[model samples]
Target chain A: MRYLRLYLHFLRFSFSRAMEFRLDFFFKIIMDCMFYVVNLGFYKILFLTTPMLAGWSEDQTMVFVSSYLLVDALHMTVFASNMWMIPFSINRGDLDSYLTRPVSTLFFVSLRDFAANSFINLLMAIGIFAYTLMNLKAPYTTGQLLFYVGCILNGWLLHYVLQMIFIIPVFWTQSSRGFSDFFFSMGVAIERPDLVYRGVLRWLLTLVLPFALIVSFPARLFFGPETPHLFLHLVFVTLAAWGFMLWFWKKGLRAYSSASS
Target chain B: MSWPARVVSTELRKILAYRSDFWVNFLGQTIIQLFIARALWQSIFESNGQTEIGGFTLSQMTLYYLLAPLTIKILMGENIGFFSREIYDGGLNRYLVWPLPPIGYKLLTYLTYSAFYTAQLALLYTFARFFLDDRPYELSEFLRLIAGLGYILVAAIGYFCMMCLCELVAFWADNTWSLGVMLRFVAGFLGGTFLPLSFYPETLREIIQYLPFAAFISGPVNLILGRSTPMEALQSFVVMLVWLPILGLAVRALWKKGNLQYTGVGM
Candidate 1:
């Protein structure tokens, strides 16, 4: 409950900050909206040449694309700003304040800023997700719909964990944006179906980096036939990622040499 | 040496200090993009059971993707927020006292970065060619490549001027970073950084091909690939030539007006 109050305070502070720059706020929304349009257009054009991509039809792939867009929008709204600031904080020893806070440092650092600018984009993403779901040929049952929503949340958490895993390396590297750039580069893997990848690349995306599990598996759960093993795999990977993030966070903190010290 | 030449040399020296950043930005990002684009096009071709799509063989498409990242790096210009940061943080005051114009200095700095980036990409492409080993080229192709380089240089200047105009908005708006982000997103789509312009419908592709955005990336790339006819390539150069001076004038006018509004307090 105390953490909840702290998060509410964070939300209030973020809203006030966003409101201070009205033009920037609207510009950011427009920027993300453009991103969504381009993403949809890319797939639309690709589908014109082929009926199926990686065992999924155009409509099914549309759902997959919409799922990832929602996942990305959710991350932007909730986690991106905080993640972007982590390197700056570490470099300047501003993280010392985070460490000294009463709340959980990991929780505080990761969730401190809710990007109000991207909130409208988040709503737009949700609208697209719902629209795609309605258009899906295989009508989802209420229970399956609920499960798909849960998996989308799981995917968002997986994204956060994956980002922090990359970010924690700043403690040792001290090169701000290096790992993040690499992270962005690797993130393209999630844009396509994992089925397209063969052998080692498949294993790497599914088991190691696990970007495939983020959106693809959730979209698979809703659109494709039942894959009980895949659900278990997603659960296992998320838990393992969470565990690794906590361990890595502690390891990074222990190695942190504060600026003042 | 002229002032702009010295400025370029100084910027070249400054860039050498951040060698790791250059490698990470170029090699790390480009290799990943290459891998993803290869996998994507491979999947598309396999799914359709055809080796060609939209006039590009699979190898040709792979080559296109390979070149796209390098082309974007050169044409996009660096220091996206250079003018805005200077104006907002009162760094413009330092430039105002100097005899050299700030826009010229900025343009020289970007050109220096572009030169460094091209050299690095040349080395990277050499490494790539070692493995690929099948990019057949004749004398005309080499001539087209040279022509494409000239067009790219013009397009880079136009792009730089446009970005400077975008940054000059900081004189009025408190934060222009969002504008930069917006510009990048729009340009990435329209400029064919994400996909080939040929992927679009004929009417849309025709419209985009004449736009400054296509001149920035798609036009020059397609010219080098021998995808465009001589007339089409000439048309692209004409579009760039027209936009460059207009954008250059806008930057000059904006900078003059913005200088009047500047009050250097934070310094």
Candidate 2:
């Protein structure tokens, strides 16, 4: 409850900051709107050439695309700006301030800065997701809809975990952009259906990086055949990712040397 | 050496000084893009049960992806935000007193960096040859490749000028980072960095073909792929040439007006 209140404070501060930069606030929305358009258009164009891609129909693929966009927007809103600061903080030893905070330092550092600009974009993404859901040819039950939302949240969490894993390497490498670039490159996997990948690459995205699960799995759960096993897979992967994050965070902190020290 | 030549060499030396940074930053990104493009295109082709889509076989499409990064490196201008930072922080005052033209200095530096990036991409291509299937090049294709390189050079200059105009928004706005990002996204989509313009609807593709963005990337790629005839390639070159001077003029005009607004108080 205390953490919730603290997060509320962060949210308030974020909005105040956003209001001070009204032009930037609008520009970010326009930029993301363009991004969303381009993303949808890419899939639309692909469908024009072929009726189905990777066994998924055009409308079904729209749901997957919308899922990733919402996940991306959520990530940008809640985590991106905060994560971007980590390398700079570590380099400058400003992370000491975070470490000294009373709350869980990892949670505090990672979630403190809500990107209020991106929050508006997040709403736009949600609108798109709703549109896609409405237009989906296959009828879904209320229970399935709720389950899909839960899975999308899981996908967002998985994205955060994967990002943190990439970021922890900065503690040693001291190269801020290197791992971040690599992470973004890997991020492209989530944009397409996981079924497109084959062999070791498929396994890598599924188990190791888990980009496949980030967006595709949630859409799969909703549209594809009922697979009770998938629920177990999602749970196992989320737990495994969470466990790995805790271990890596602890290890990174131990190696951290404060500037004053 | 001439002043411009000297500037280029100095910038080239600076890039060489931090060559490892390039490998870490660029090479990883290029490889990742290649991986995604190859996987996505292969899957699409497999699902369609067709050997060709938009005149590109799977191997040809893979080759296009491999070459697109190189073309982008040579043609797509960097968003250095140098002039913007200078204007915002009063660093422009230092350049104003310098002997050389600031724009010339910037252009030379950008060209030098592009040259280094192209050389690095060439090295990667040599390495990639072992992994990728070889595609035979006809004499006409080689000639078109040379022509494509010329077009890429002009497109790079035009893109640099356009970026300069975008960055000049800092003169009025507090920050131009958002504008820079918008410019990049627009360019990436319209320039065919994400996918071939041919993949777009025919009407849209036809319109984009004449847009400066196509001149930047897709036009060059089409030339190298032998997708466009000699006349068509020449027409794209003409389009690039037309846009470059207009963009150059806009940059010069913006810089002149922006200079009047410069307070140089930050220094």
Candidate 3:
């Protein structure tokens, strides 16, 4: 309850701040919309020459794209700005401020900036998602829809975990951005349907590094024939990932030789 | 070394100083992106059941994706916000005090990043040759590769001018980072960095053929891949050349206007 109240404050302040830079707010929306267009266009153009991409018809592929976009939108709205600041704060030794706060440092740092600008984009993403679902040939039940939304939320959490895992390494490497570029390079998988991957690569993306699971697992649950086992596997991996990130984050704090010192 | 040359060289060395950055920026990104592209194109060809899509074999398409990002890095360079930062934070005051053309110094640093990435491309191409099944290049295609690189280098200046004009917007706008990002996304999409021009709708492809973005990326990659003869490459180069002066003049005009507006108050 307390955390939720704090988040409300964060959202309120973020929205107020966003109004100050109205032009930037709008430009960011346009920028993200273009990104959506390109992602959809990529699959669209490929489907032009082919009947199926990894067994998903063009409409199904569009749904997958929309799913990823929603994940992206939610991640951007809730986490991206906050997660992006971790390495910088670590580098500047500004972690001291957060650590001294009365609230849980991790919760405070992670949810402090709500990215109200991107919340608009999130709504836009939902519109795009609705548009795609209208074309979805296969009808889904209310249970399935609710389950899909739950999986997407999990996907967003996984993205946050991955980002923390990538940025926390700044404690030792002390590089400005840590492993973000590599993480982003790997994130290309999220834009692509995991069905396109095969064999070792598939397992690697699903279980090991789990970049593909960001949208792929949730997407699979929504689109593929009942893969309860696979969904359970996603749950397990996501839990394990969270455990690792929390442990790694603690270790990073221990290693965090303050920059000024 | 001359003053500006030493400045650029020293700045380049500083950027390469962070060992982690050096690895991620040069080595890891290229390798990972290539892996994804390889997987994607493989699935594409298998699903399509076509040996050729838009006149490209899987191997040729792989080569195109590889060259696309590299060519774009050379053309777009790094977005260090040299001018944009100065404009926003009143750092331009220092540049005005210094006996230098801030634009010239900024270009030197910008192209240094491009040059560094170009070296990365060359190094990766050499490494790739060992892993690739066939000889990656023919002796006959050698001159065309050289010609393509030559045109890319010249085109880099034109791209620099365009970006300069963009960063100049900071003088007027409250922030321009969004503009910078918008430009990159637009450039990537239009320049065929995201996908081949062949994948584009015919009308869109024809329109983009005359655009500088295609000439900057598609024109160079195709020429290096031996898809285009010297004459054809020259035709593309001519298209880019026409934009060069227009962009350069725009940069000059914008900078003059921006300087007039610049209060250097750190506002």
Candidate 4:
């Protein structure tokens, strides 16, 4: 309950900071939208050449792109700005200030830098998602939307938990920027659909890293409803990653030799 | 005797003193580029067959990605925006007091950073060669590679000078870091750092073909990939030369205007 209040305060402050500069807000929105438009343009070009890539139809692929964008925006809204700051805090011992706070140090540091600019990105992602869904003319029941939202919420948690786990090494290494980028690179797998994988890669996606589960399984809820097993796996994986991140954070906190010394 | 040799030696000594952050940043940057390149390559493979893309085979594409970041480091990824920092903090005041002219001091600082960036690029290239798959080039190809590299070098200098002009705006704006970031993004996206401009529509590509950003990275990468012949390469070089002097003049003009209106804030 206390943590929820802390998170709410962080979100409120972060949103205000984003809106602090009206021009910055509008420009960022336009810029991000232009980037998404380019991706949409890429898809249009590809579809003109062929109906499908790697065995998925245009509508299916659009859903894949939409899901990736949605998950990405969700991650940005919740975590990106904070994750990027971890390095600076570790290097400057600013994490120490957060540590001394009344709230959870992890929660404080992770949620402190709410990116105001990303609100536009978030809205844009939702708009694109809606357009894709409408184009597909897919049936939308309240139960389905609820489950879709639930899976995406779980997906967002999975992303955050993995990020925290990857960044935990910063406490021990004193610098983890390289590791962070590498994690992001590996995390790129989440952006593609799981249908694209085969054999060992499929098993790897399911069991080992589970990058495919991030976008694919949640998207499956909408596009491939027959895949109930994947949705269950998504929940399972999210819980497992959440547990791993919590364990790692605890161990990392013990190893944290405050930067001042 | 030459200006570059003189600046590079002093810069090398200074860079060595702060080598840890330098190497870490270089390695970190390389890793990010590699990942992005890998992701894009995977996408391309998924979309198209195992054929050449914009005249590059899969292995060659990876090689281009590997070299692109190193090329960026060599050309324009240094302290290209140091002028903005100096303008913001009134560090330009020191340059004004020096026996060397302020503009000359700024240019030397630019050269110094470029020197450090070159060393860092070399380190990254060494690391890349270990892990990345690239085809061997013939003697003639190596010559063309040199010519292409020259194009990127001049283009980087021209682009950096233009950025220095943007940084000079710090003399007027309350903060220009966002502008700097926006400018870099323009350069990166338009210049084909994120993805090649070749991927754009013919009309858009034709228009960007003339823009300063295309000349920065894409033009050179295309040249090195043997996508353009010597005539086209020479034409690109001519375009860069034309842009360089214009940007240099603009930098001077902005600096003069900024200094006149300088509030000497937060010095």
Ranking by DockQ: 3, 1, 2, 4
In terms of lDDT, the poorest run of 10 residues in model 1 chain A is A173-182
Per-residue CA lDDT of candidate 1, range A122-186, in tens? 99999998898778887678998888889989999999999898888778767665378778877
Pairs of residues at least 3 apart in sequence or in different chains that clash in candidate 3: none
What tens-digit string does per-residue lDDT give for candidate 3 at B231-252? 8778888899998988988999
Candidate 2 Cα misplacement greater than 4 A, ranges: A259-261, B1-21, B125-140
- For candidate 4, the per-residue lDDT at B105 reads 55
User: How does residue B222 of candidate 1 score in lDDT?
Assistant: 85
Off by over 4 Å in 1: B1-6, B13-21, B126-130, B133-137
- Candidate 3 off by > 4 Å: B133-137
Writing each residue's lDDT as its tens digit, candidate 2 over B1-267 gives 889988887877765554454565575578767877888889889888899998888877876887776777675445457678888888887875789888888888887767666666556654564456465545775576666666677678888887798788788877677776787778778888878877887789778877898888878878866777778878878888888889989998998998888898742
Residue B74, candidate 3: Cα error in Å is 2.3
| Candidate with maximal TM-score | 3
Query: Candidate 1 at residue A115, lDDT?
Result: 98
Error of 4 at B49 (Å): 5.2
Q: Classify candidate 4 by CAPRI docking class.
A: incorrect
Worst 10 residues of 4 chain A by lDDT: A176-185
Cα lDDT of candidate 2 equals 0.81
List, in order, the clash count of every candidate structure.
Answer: 0, 0, 0, 1
TM-score to true structure, per model: 0.94, 0.93, 0.96, 0.80
Report the lDDT tens digits of candidate 2 across residue range A160-246: 999898888767765544277678767888898888888888888888889899988888889869578987887898899999989
What lDDT does candidate 2 reach at residue A191? 96
With candidate 3 superimposed using the best TM-score fit, by how many Å does residue A223's alpha carbon deviate from the native?
Answer: 1.4
